[model samples]
Target: MSWLRPQDVVEKALAASTADAQVTYVVESSEANLRWAGNSLTTNGSMRSRQVVVISFVDGGAGMATGTVARTGSPDVAELVAASEQAARDAGPAEDAVPLVAEPPPGAGEWDADAAETSIGVFTDVAPALAEAFGEARGREELLFGYAEHAMATTYLGTSTGLRLRHDQPAGRVELNGKSADMSRSVWAGVGTRDFADVSVADLAGEVARKLAWSRRRVELPAARYETLLPPSAISDLMIYAYWTMEARDADEGRNVYAKAGGGNRVGERLAALPLTLRSDPFAPGLEACPFQVVGGSSGSASVFDNGMATPAVDWISGGVLTNLIRPRAWALNTTAPATAAVDNLLLESPGATATQDEMVAATERGLLLTTLWYIREVDPQTLLLTGLTRDGVFLVEGGEVTGAVNNFRFNESPVDLLGRITEAGRTERTLPREWSDWFTRAAMPTVRVPDFNMSSVSPAS
Candidate 1:
């Protein structure tokens, strides 16, 4: 649908709202996708939806109800508004109710015409090249599986208070997993980019093939602490966990890793020894994101009921110091602090000489090379300790070269601790984590060398 249609839907929802209630409409429309498996395309699908949410304020209580409609259907705005009003009458008072945004900040309705008009032909044109790459696999024992998705989504937010916001995001991702016949060895390589031209299926296929060849002979090593080299993919995983713990309220409440030792939060403390900087900027080149973050509603600033809260470049860590933490508007107001929103992308930067993954491996006298992490889960919030298994590819380095593929192992480590122990850092590049790629897609991570990385146990899975 064109931009005018989405605006009309929002206007209808607003016109249906009662005097005592505030209505907000959110419309999202996405293009079709293609799914692939076993080296072939499998399914094609598309999704287009719109939802209208009404917030009724009565007797200090606020209640919300959402009504949804598909692309081919009409919305029941009146019924949804009535339901929300009734719910407010039946519920208790809202303790943290704030008025809806009266006026949206400037630049709320910025539009990217190119992104909004992305077509399905982009995926169709690339499918043949991807298939050809897969067919180039050497042996019959090798198998391939993954998906290619092209999506163009527009989010429109309109409030009864006259706040209007809209953003169009175009995204494309290609993931490929290759494995040997016996499932004894495997490798994963993929690309996620807003521009389809950036995704090179040939390079992805070559990397998988190279890694699979390196894993033909397996070597078993007893679990022990060792110096380790982590590629961008593995480092991106650590950064994601670090960002999740940057909530200001959690730290102020004395429950998160950033809680102070005595009193107050650890905002100014030096968290790592290395001069590392982690930041987020919506306008960052090659990693652009929406200019505004969602605010208000039950989920606070994380809500999809966006209120046009402008997102600016935020420095979470600078020069290895704890610099800033994300704060929801409600919590910020209650505590007399500045409101901040969590960012969609993260960038990790280090100074001095930059090296590539291969160069980092060549410099390491003895260490383990981790391709990526899998099934990572938090073990301790205070220390930011995490546990996960190494998968896809793991190797042992001897004499500044990868000697052999090592058995998978479960590792217990913390991003915070890892940064503090960093012996070297290489050049940063946009990378996708094995896990959490769906959410944290944009990251420029570097190869990191850490001493005494804890490998806790062995895993039988490749």
Candidate 2:
């Protein structure tokens, strides 16, 4: 049987919602997914249910009830509706419910691509291939790791003011890992997309193969700030997190480094140098996600932004000056909705003029190339101070060439400071996961060369 459409579900839920009394909003969502992993082709599948109903009673109060199912029957539905109405009543009065925008203009289609159109079996097969490749690599012991997730979710929303909207997202990720000679070090890679066709396990295996081969040599890296190159994958993770942690709430509380005095906020402040422009674009090719707010449930869908806000496509540290801060809905309302707040996902745009890996090395003069970051954590929320270990691969480059794999080092650095020191960037691209979306990032980055990279300390064991 075809699953319940958002509109149909909304109609049924609304029938139950308005039965007893005042009901401001009723929203519901549902999801189903299939995933696979390992050398074995066992398919992993799951189905999830969610609903959240926001109510406003005549007594000037509001309430909400959220759960995996909408209702069992008449009394259950009555109880839920009553509970929601009472909760709204109990919260006392806030603001009059603002009129949500009218339903979006008709669209050609939902993002639900044909399920039969793709298969993750190839992605499933990649794990063993990576393990096999690692096994073949001389002086390297293959350490196999695997992961895959295929997910789908639907949103059905209804508000008393004639607002109705529905949307859903289907997406997934697949990955593998391999280790080296002493097993003290290793390499990692993964692929992800809304459709399984894009998740090539073989390609993932090949990437691990490169890491296995490239990380053969071990050298000691000297402690000092030096020019460094970052691949695209790593670049994506750092930039994305930089935005997530820079919340307006954090800034207001003076927890963010970019916080300003007198509660005016810091939107256009000069934070970083030129060349770092971070923005969010939901329309970017191959990366479009649902532009609806489901509030962590499987029901009703509102416009992607929690409140009446548009998604931002441009973010800036133009010419290396701090430019924008992502603002969430509640914060936006408190601040009168500045354009600096973003509902879209983050994207760090790099110019086309960046040097290629070879060009970056040629211009390096001397530096280090960091493959991946590990155990990254916050030191100071205000300044973006972070501490993490170099992992998977770390190489020393001298006079335009990778000298060899260097023993991983531990360092503390600021995201703001690191981006500011960039002397050169590479042209290549790699897709990395954002902080909100995935377990580990897969960054496609190019070599970068910086001067005076500080190695605050070293690890006896990496």
- Top model by lDDT, which number? 1
TM-score for each candidate, following the candidate numbering: 0.90, 0.76
Residue 130, candidate 1: alpha-carbon lDDT: 70
Per-residue alpha-carbon lDDT of model 2 for 1-462, expressed as tens digits? 134443544455557664223222222322333333323334444444445444433433252322223342122444655666555444543332233334442321332232222233434554455445444543334455555666554444554445555445455666566665457667777655655656666667677777676677777766666667766655666666676666666676676666787775576776554465655554555566435433322111122224312344555465566665655543556667553434335455457756666677667667787766666788877678887777677777778877777777777777677777766666645465533345433233344555666667775645
lDDT against the true structure, per candidate, is 0.74, 0.53
- Give candidate 1 regions above 4 Å deviation: 1-4, 19-23, 56-73, 110-119, 139-141, 295-297, 300-306
Q: Which regions of candidate 2 fall more than 4 Å away from where they truly are?
A: 1-6, 18-79, 92-143, 249-253, 261-263, 296-312, 316-321, 328-341, 428-430, 434-448
Q: Per-residue alpha-carbon lDDT of model 1 for 143-169, expressed as tens digits?
A: 777877766667666676677778766
